[model samples]
Target: MEVRSAPSLLPILRSRQQGEVLTYLMCDPDRETSMSELAHRVGVPLSSVHREVERAEAAGIITSRRSGNTRFVRADTDSPYYDSLSDLLVKAFGPPHVLAEALEGVEGIEAAYVYGSWAARLHGVAGRRPVNDIDVLVLGEPDRAELYEALGGVEGRLGRPVNVVIRDAGWLRDGSGSFHATVTERPVVAIEIKKQLGRDPVPQSS
Candidate 1:
């Protein structure tokens, strides 16, 4: 059985709990979760969940409200809790900041954003690591040769080759005009606005 800590300890303990809440919310930001459910998932009692939820709400870590008889919870990443949770995530997942320099400093590269499972693990950043091949969503409609040039730039920068994706709305349909549901289905982690913009360029945060 877990003993309830002193009132003063609540503040200290809430940080970790806040991180848990954020992790859940990050998976699906729109849905609402209940206090009882959250307590069960976290292995804490309802009363503690209530108190922590209240504190987190005040700190803007999460937003809570009464829906009839239930209190719902979700992570507010824009809140300061984001920084703490991000740090915890890095500690939990093996650190891989080295990938940033590899992807970022390449010439002719329009823009890059991470997507997929590895991207989910990174803090609101959309890229995965320990991946067999890096999956990056790039922008523009460069020809195959031009695209190869851009990809080569990334390969040179990273000391390893990475697949480069150039997004083009104009190329939405090929000769057959068939839909490429594949690109639309790509999992999105975060939408990045490029410091260097061209077309509808968005970065996948890492």
Candidate 2:
């Protein structure tokens, strides 16, 4: 696929899919993933992801191997571009992924989403001003202190401020406020929080 001419959050990349694919592989170099899982995580179609992975592999940006009938890919750590490119990806396209990782096992959280300008840009909405910070909306009854503490370092990691808004699940379902209305009306990207297994679980009581 040809590079998009439209302005993108990561201006240097060919397409959002390209950025997502590269970020997923490069930012987590130690992990290897199947193409289908890569597609699911990046929210891009399998065909598009396959093409991007093929191009990246051809350029030595990533490497792939066959595991039975499955094709798995990972970042080529030896590539001269690995270090710099991974850093760039982490800064530009790493919010949802990074936030998800950070909030993975935090208790009392039902769902999380990134909304506002960052989401607008991710959803391909052209904007007049550059996105300066991330706005996250959490839906659940998580401990306020714990939630904030969990997200404390996100700003440093992303090199920008992260403003999070907490709302209970009841409010999301029944509230009629303008804030709720606006958020429901706008583009929001869901953060996928995977459960941590085979490790000591976070204590329910401190």
Candidate 3:
């Protein structure tokens, strides 16, 4: 017997690549992204990203231009579907970037990742049920109270609960827990936290 999987996070899109492409471009409409950068960020081949860009361009979802030997693209903000599509992508595929932005300036966070079912979908894994929440793994000694406060409204923005698991860097390097083993073996989306200058590195009490 065979089992069937549920639809992806955005069933309206034809493929995960399509969703990823749109998400990266639409979520950051103000910036122009190079094709190579898009491919690198989307974790797909250049040729594959090019095809998706062409399809999106043909549909007026994005616009592209060439500079020297590189091609840059951004969301077509003039399109009628731009607003709604961007909102959808933000809710469906924008966790890593969104969470990264939200976590910025909070002291003592060395690294972060989005794992579990939402990440499984981002990794193109088909599941029996749709993802209903986001799981985040934070490796650092960030103040728990500050951390939670930073992420307080993420659920309201993403339309799903955001579950965060915090641990020290040592745990990631040498932990023997079953949970650590599972997360290490699975696909996890890395979240980049930009450290702000002039901010104290002290970890506040919870």
Candidate 4:
């Protein structure tokens, strides 16, 4: 089930703006957001966001309400496709979404990060080459088999092999080590798993 790269969500979605809009709203279903907020987060014009919101509402994908001068919108959890769409969005953008979902409920994952070439591009690595595999640096003592089983879904979604390197607090503490030095020196995409707060968060190096 290994893949070479992440799959594009554009084909299934109406446009890039639509995908962004879905990712934002779907990621935080409980939170209600305003048109301006959605526009800002999606990096699209207010008009475009408004149109997309309207379309989504008509399709019963989103629900809207008015609070005086501002209108608030939230995903319709009751929608028939709610779970399905949520899964699709997560798999479509595996870095955080899929990775986060996979790591959920796993035993001992402290903090996880996406490193190497894929992370480099996300960190705006200039002239970065395409990534054929995803390099994940996991911290803590989670079972290796369990971790791989979790990431198996992500491998299919991203169309790339997920090469995971497990490390405990001891390895993370050794700043002198080559692996630690390289990850600390480069861009790393943190996987924010709320339950596994094993230690203080490691700030990504700028």
Candidate 5:
């Protein structure tokens, strides 16, 4: 799995840091986070997070309240742009973020990628309809019970169910038949999981 920043989210929010800030606040609307916490989660400077949070406040996209010396911020549901931006952020960053967080440190996972409608939308494919469910393709045999438990957090965050398909490593490595072909042809967002160690999840053409 490649460790990379989400450049796809930049155009939607005009800044990756801002998008991340929004993700933390809006993904779980009830939860309030401080600028310092956002900075840590977003892997950016505290000053940058402060600037984005202030900008969001000015735009009425989010609201901040003080608790003693600490201030916590959350999305302003009253703002008309709140729902739309939340949906966009969920689509752009939700699955990848969820997958990485949930599946990290879980054993027997070689690789993971998001496919189907959600992935199509992520890549900006023309005519891709609204995504109602997330489709995840997981390589290596993981315990079904544990995997489902992990995915529960993702479902809650995205407000949709996650449909995960587990496959054997050899099945993909051998380039077996139509399923492999379809996965290779379509738009796929590779998930950077901490436990993955194997061949490329995506197949190369002959």
Candidate 6:
């Protein structure tokens, strides 16, 4: 499963300060959810949760209806965009990238960015189909692409396919990036600190 693109998740991410709230609601397992339960689960103030819910409803990511005093939220998975994004997620989390990073034994890889589906889950939006393969952006080096290729080979020896995205420290310094804006958002995972450490609590070292 290879994902070139997903539903314009860009819209969902940029939908305001409540991006995490709406994302959690859509990814919740319940077909229809209640306002109070949602607020409680997200651990935000009731008022702030309500504000986000309203914004999400307007964006059409969720469907809400009143039954007596409760409002239910069901994800619009039927939306034309849902399938595309879901498929991308299936392909994205295929294998853990920590396997590669730990084996490489090369320091200065700097920041390892786990973008895409796994990041969405970290923010509390778990897709039905999650692959868990680490999708990373390696922010380091003077030459971006060439450096990525070199690191990719190092991981290749470790048996994990590493898609290392090298970012030129100088270019990053200059702020000329109009291309990588899509992946710059926060990572989608539950244990975010594991991302920085470059190792899982339980190593899958079969």
> Which predicted model would earn the best lDDT?
2
Q: Across residues 93-140, which tens digit of lDDT does each residue of candidate 3 receive?
A: 899878988899678888888888888776667788878999998877
Each candidate structure's TM-score, on Cα atoms with residue i matched to residue i, is: 0.34, 0.87, 0.83, 0.62, 0.59, 0.36
**CA shift of 160, model 2, Å:** 0.8
Can you tell me which runs of candidate 3 are displaced by over 4 Å? Answer: 1-7, 196-206
Give the root-mean-square deviation of each candidate in angstroms.
13.4, 6.6, 6.8, 7.1, 6.7, 13.7
**Candidates, ranked, lDDT:** 2, 3, 5, 4, 1, 6
Task: Quote model 1's TM-score.
Answer: 0.34
Q: CA lDDT of 170 in candidate 6?
A: 39
Residue pairs in clash, model 5: none
Cα error of candidate 2 at position 65, Å: 1.0
Question: Which pairs clash inside model 3?
Answer: none
In terms of TM-score, the best-performing candidate is 2
Task: Answer with 5 or 6, whichever has the higher TM-score.
Answer: 5
Write down the lDDT that model 2 would get.
Answer: 0.80
lDDT of each: 0.47, 0.80, 0.79, 0.72, 0.74, 0.47
Candidate 3 lDDT score relative to the true structure: 0.79
Cα deviation of 190 in candidate 5 (Å)?
Answer: 1.1
Between candidates 2 and 6, name the one with more favorable TM-score. Answer: 2
lDDT tens readout by residue for model 4, 47-106: 888988999899998999999999999989999978778666644444665687788878
Prediction 4 global C-alpha lDDT: 0.72
Candidate order by decreasing TM-score: 2, 3, 4, 5, 6, 1
- What TM-score does model 3 achieve against the real structure? 0.83
